[model samples]
Target: MKNILNNVVSLIVVMIVLLLIIPLSPFFLDVMIILNIAVSLIILLVSMNIKEALEFSIFPSLLLITTLYRIGINISSTRSILSNSGTAGQVIQSMGDFVLQGNVVVGVIIFLIIVLVQFLVITKGAERVAEVAARFTLDAMPGKQMAIDADLGSGLITEDEAKERRYKIQKEADFYGSMDGATKIVKGDATMSLIITAVNFLGGCVIGMVQGTMGFTEVLQVYSIATIGDGLVSQIPALLISTATGMIVTRAVAEDSLNIDVTRQFGAQPKAIMIAGGVLAILIAIPGMPKFQLAVIALTMMLGGWYLLRRMEEFSRVPEPAMAPGGGMSPTDIEQMQMEDEENFKDINSVYDLLSVEPIEMEFGYSLIPLVDEASGGRMIDRIVIFRRQYAQEMGLVIPSIRLRDSSSLNTNQYVIKIKGEEVAKGEILVDYYLALEPPNLEKEIDGIDTIEPAYGIPSKWITVDKKEMAEIYGYTVIDPLSVMLTHLSETVKKHAHELLNRPEVVRLVENMKRQAPELVEELIPQLISYGNFQKILTNLLKEGIPIKDMETIMETIVDSSMTVRDLDSITENIRVALKRTITRKFCEGNSMRVVTLDAELEKTIITSLTNGDHGVYLALSPEVMQGVITQMTEEVRKFQELGQVPIILTSQVVRVHFYRLVEQFFPDVFVLSFNEISNNIQIQAVGNIAV
Candidate 1:
């Protein structure tokens, strides 16, 4: 039975092919016509009921099969009409008698109109829509795939979920592309129906006339009904399939079926319905208007609108508490309400909730509340979400949700960003103005209040909306107030990203890695290096703005280095070498890198000053030497700044950690690279040599 069910479609297709070549009795022909109508109806209903196009992924193939079956039926009916004196079957004859009713011309005109509607209107529109949908779906594949990767990187989805999403995207692309070509088949079928109708009418007339069994008028009366009936039978099913094609292509991703969606949408707008009824009622005032019919329709519409409004009111109304004998609650009801209130307040005195601090928080004043309130069209939360996803993909660390609240103590326009409940950065925004950064070469001077761009501390002005275009034309970078706040929040989070990676987050990262390389995780974690040491290494890398996305290589480096040395600094340095490609990709400009290097004398001094203590390693340089080194490093970095490039300081692997700690307090943004940490293919150009 299972095998028979599996091959039913194949058997039906073979039978359809045979129908084109073989003759059929009237009874069998009637059955096939009825089946064709049933199948078309089923296809139409299925298309309307589906939630998404991929749910009906077999629609494209089914369209071809049904079209072939339809064409085969048309052939058999044509042969029967000409061979049996304009009588194809009982179904066709009844339809002809019903439509014609002694008026052949009207029936033919109606048939032609149906065919034109299917061919010109429905089929043509669906074809264009399918073509555009296919093109857009194909064009969006890269972005969709990138989004999946971002979600996977952020640990929002597992690998299996990511694969499923990717597969669905590809399937959607293929389905639309197939639909683009399948619509053409619908168009061709419509055209073929017309041709077959003409052949049935003309061929039946000639056969009857040549037989000398009827006059011209008699032949016309007999064949005209048959032709219209055959055309209607074939074209009605074709029309249904064509409409189904339009429905599937135009259907958006919706939760409900077509009927429910349409009804609910229309019912949601009582005011529109009432206004439409009023317009129709007013139409009765115009001359030559049918007052009675318009009055009936207008009354029905007004009643429907009133009913909808009443239903909405009922749903929105809150029920009042039932009154007891003395206009107060009964004893039982009072006890129940008191018990519910107690249940709700049970957690009020919990100290654990009070002591818990958010990893990050943003507090704003009341005047800047609109920038965070979604109800007021604020996008602070949305912008933060995008920043988190992008930062996760780039840095291999997912940012925890930043808590946002309005602080009454701050200035009206001021906002503070906090990490671990301590304020780290604060900025102010003008609700009604745009910030325009000053360009180096001013094209034209514009009037506005002077300010500094909060994110980067660049000289800027808060300009009104009317001056926005003028500012842009003058080569000033304009940003809105909300964007200014979001940019500040994003930068602050990145600067303190290392502080956010607690033990739990590290455990999450480990669990995620275990899925891909379980053996490595099982072998290296805790046995070779404790979790605290592993996290310290990661935190150190992030503190210097390095991504730990290459987890496998980091683990392998740790496993190898732990056998020889037990120092965290050496293990981290070795991991950095293993991640040279990542480092180069992050900091290098193509194959060439302009950097500041330490002179041999300075390197020897730093090596001599290096000391090993309980904390691990430190540079014990004197205050005078440290100040001179900082001054010289500042001068070299300024040279790179003059040429519009970021400063990078290169040193030997042994002195890299000590030197980084020395300059970290003074030059936080400067990158310190050791020779071993840079890829060999990159050409290094020493722009300056820092020495003391």
Candidate 2:
């Protein structure tokens, strides 16, 4: 499991300890669950990434415990109460009974659903806000201001995909009451686990309370009430359901999100797992089951299946293609397989066209030739010039008709004139045509005006009386089709490159690598060596303190141009590297949620430049909301910084309170931005990046 998920689990275990031992009024329990539900609902107001139904575990248990505590010694009566009344007792008992059954589990499920789906991303003054929070979270650790640690995991998201993901997260935030990019600010893995455990624990307690009251507390009495075979037969469905559920959960655990509680991905969704448990509940409730038969079947199925499934899932059962219950394969996978084995070409005609000439000739961000004068530039904008008798005749005022390319407005019309191998644009004026058609002034003997016009149906040829030199017949010429297309493709690729460079995650990853990866520098040497010698591009990343393995991976990825996280899993040797223990210590000490107002003076800029002035209040979420907040925040802040504009932020102390723990735990030398109050101005300063 990831550390964030783990910590969340730990927090949940602690809360459940409270839930188990504390003897609050049923009202207090109601209130606690309600408040949590409300907060969770707030998340639903935004676009949420994970569903929260996994929380049902708490309710079932809570029901059992509550029922046991309430019924005490009345086994038969409690069972009678549960079976009748159609989910609500008469008016007198309705309120009380409903609180136990209707309110707790249902309310929590509704609320958690809200939290999981809501997104509400906020960004105005987020950097300065997150910074102060980070500092406070770090506490009074020495030299923390200079340490910096960054993970290049996000660089694994392709530029286009990152933009899309960012958009989704941001739109979710927009649905909420804030507008900062909080997706990366507060780690969410821990928060999600917390929600799950809280919900599940409450659910389990409820289930235990309700069932135990119906003689479940004296389960031995139930077998005595009926035959062993009859009791065992009653729970066959529960047996299948529990086994299937356990099988699914066991399959889904993994070890990433380092320090978070998220299990690496197994195949099952949380809902599917919970439903599996629900199936068990429904199965156990089936009527007329014999005790011994039900027990034997359920026990056999649950124990044997659990063991087999656990081994299959946790140890060796690899992810197979997704399938339907009674099918050979799913539609998506079948389509994918078909595509993978597809023929290379449907028809082969032009072999040269098949080569990737466009990508080769015009790689993204690669430069096209520079031009001093656009008129003289090598752009072959071809023009067609048709010369007929009417235009020449009109120019000369001598013949009945001669046509020319520009008899009306030659001043603005340009032409593709081939000058050597390069193409140039030049005008063909009416004056040139005029000279060609000038009437023969043989009686007067003038320049070209002395030439004779050919007779009708005669070839206008062989006017060779000029002594020194005759004017060259010039118009326009065609340019190569392939080269023109290449130039156009190059321009488009460069445009896309600029957009990619500006991406928030890409900016931070590259900057971090530039600062911290020396070995990475050596790896990239191969890419540039063929460029023969190159100018060194010094960047902020050279400061260093990053782990050698991580640095190597970053360098290798950058050099190889990797585009996805799955690619990282395949290529990086140091997969699943543990996060430093220091993060655990630091983060544990700070407040969970940190809030700050935007700088009063530049509030407009904070709003306008970052979020179009639509954002007003800024609330940074709980550090427990996620595990990798610091690294993500660094990337976002770097994106803003790359814009060459500094964002207004809250004071430094608050930043430390929220994110310092992460800094000390994860970074080698973390770079920090500190905001302070100075007269009526917010003064921001760098707390030189620190090494974690």
Candidate 3:
């Protein structure tokens, strides 16, 4: 029985096709016709009850099968009717006699009307709707996927949720696209029903007359009723299915079934119902109008409307306020809410909530809240999400969720970005103004308040909306206030990203890499280096802006280096050389890299100053020599800035690490690379030589 049930659908489909070729008895034909109507009704109800279209993803295939079954039943009924002398079965005979009531012309006209309505009206509209829906769904897929990605990157959704949403999107597209073509099948079925009905009537008339078995008038009455009955039996179910097609295609993202939604929506409008009742009552004054009937309907509508209005008012009313002794209303909602909040805070377990800190946070002044509020048309959050996705793709680091809040302690235009709990960067943004950065070669001057760009410390001005275009025309880079704040936030996060790579994040990275290179992780982790040392190596690389996306190479380099050296710095340096291709792609513009190099004398001094200690390595240079080296390094870096290039200091492998640590505080933005860390295909040009 279970095996038969499992293959029931296939068995039924083959039977339906066989029914088309085999002759059916009247009783069996009636059973198939009734089942066709039942199946169509079930489809209709299911389509109406579904809240989303994907819930009925199999609807298109079901529609094709039902349509084929209906066609098969029509063929069988037509055979029974023609062969049995204008008699199919009890079902059709009963419907014919009931609808005709001895009027053949009227019954035939009604049958034609039903077929036309199904064909030209419902089926036509459903087909068009399905076509348009399929087109729009396909076009919007890329944008929807991007939104899911953005939400995932910003920590709004988990990976599993993203995959589920993407799967639903694809399923929805497939369903709609199938529906677009399936609707045409419904249209053809309606047409076929009409053609079969015509053939039955005309063929019966010709056969009865030629055989001289019945007169012309008798043939018309008998054949016309049987034809109308067969058509009605088939067309009724087709109409129901057609309406269902329209319903599913036109359905939006609804929260409830169609019946509930329609009821709730209609009940929400009492005024319209009352107005309609009034109009009906006024219509009773017309001549020859049915006054008594109109009065009953109008009174019913008016009373129902009044009852609905009272219920709506009762639900919407606020609680009565208690009176104070001073003739004032007792504590307002805000005060009540505050009291409730204080009551909750009294719980001992709630104290732990106060001690927890977000990994990344941004607090803005009250005036700047609009920049982060999506309801106010601000896209700062969206911009930040896009940056998060782009950064993760490029840097192989997932940034923690950045919390945003409004603070009353700060100035009205100021916003502060914090890592863990301490403030790292702060800036001001004028809500109604744009920040225009001054170009080095200015063509003209624009009127605005002078300021500095927070992200890069470039000279800029806060200009009103009216001056934005002019400022752009004058060779100034103009940005909105929200964008200004977003840039400041992005740069701040990038600068402190290394500090944000905590233990939990490192574990997640290792687990992610383990999926791709399981052996590498198993051999290197806890075997050659512990998790803490692995994190330290990654942090050291990130501190200098090197991407750890190629985790396999990093782990392989670590494993090889662990054989010779136990120092984390040495392992990191080896990994850097292994990631030379990624570094070259990031910093170098083309085959040739223009950089600043240390003089041979300065390089020798730096190598000599490097001393090995328990902490791995350190540079022990005198303050006098350090000061001279900084001054000369500063001058050489300035030359790169003049030429509009990032300051890169290329040195030998031994001096690169210690030299970067020596000048890191003064030149945090500068890039320090060893000759071995650069790819051999790229040519190096020494634009300036730093010497002490």
Best by the lDDT measure: 1
Which of candidates 1 and 3 is the stronger one according to lDDT?
1
Q: Which stretches of candidate 3 lie over 4 Å from their true place?
A: 1-3, 80-84, 150-158, 211-213, 270-275, 305-352, 361-386, 404-418, 421-489, 513-534, 552-567, 610-628, 642-644
lDDT of 3 by residue, 449-495 (tens): 99999998889999999988899999999998988898899899989
lDDT of 2: 0.31
Per-model lDDT = 0.90, 0.31, 0.89
Query: Which lDDT tens digits does candidate 2 get at residues 1-692?
Result: 68878698457545545654444443443344333334334433221222321222232232233223222212222232233311111221333233224344443354344333321212212223434433433342221111110011213345466455555443332322121123122223224333433433343345445655544433322222221111111122122222222221221132322123233232224344444544554566678756566555656555554554565567665777788677778888888877765643434544546562111121111112121112455231111001112212222111111111212222332222222222222222111132232222212222333322211111112223341134222221111222333333323322222222223433343455577765666556544321111111111111111122243443554455433432222222211112122212222223221222223332332223322124332334344533444545566455534443322223243332123333434542233322321222222243222111
Global Cα lDDT for candidate 3? 0.89
lDDT of 1 by residue, 96-176 (tens): 888999998899898999999999999999999999999999998976777676566556899999999999999999999
What TM-score quantifies how close candidate 3 is to the native fold?
Answer: 0.83
Candidate 2 global TM-score: 0.16
Reference-based lDDT, residue 189, model 1: 95
Measured against the true structure, the TM-scores of the candidates, in listed sequence, are 0.80, 0.16, 0.83
* Stretch of 10 with least lDDT, candidate 2: 143-152
Higher-lDDT candidate of 2 and 3 = 3
lDDT of 1: 0.90
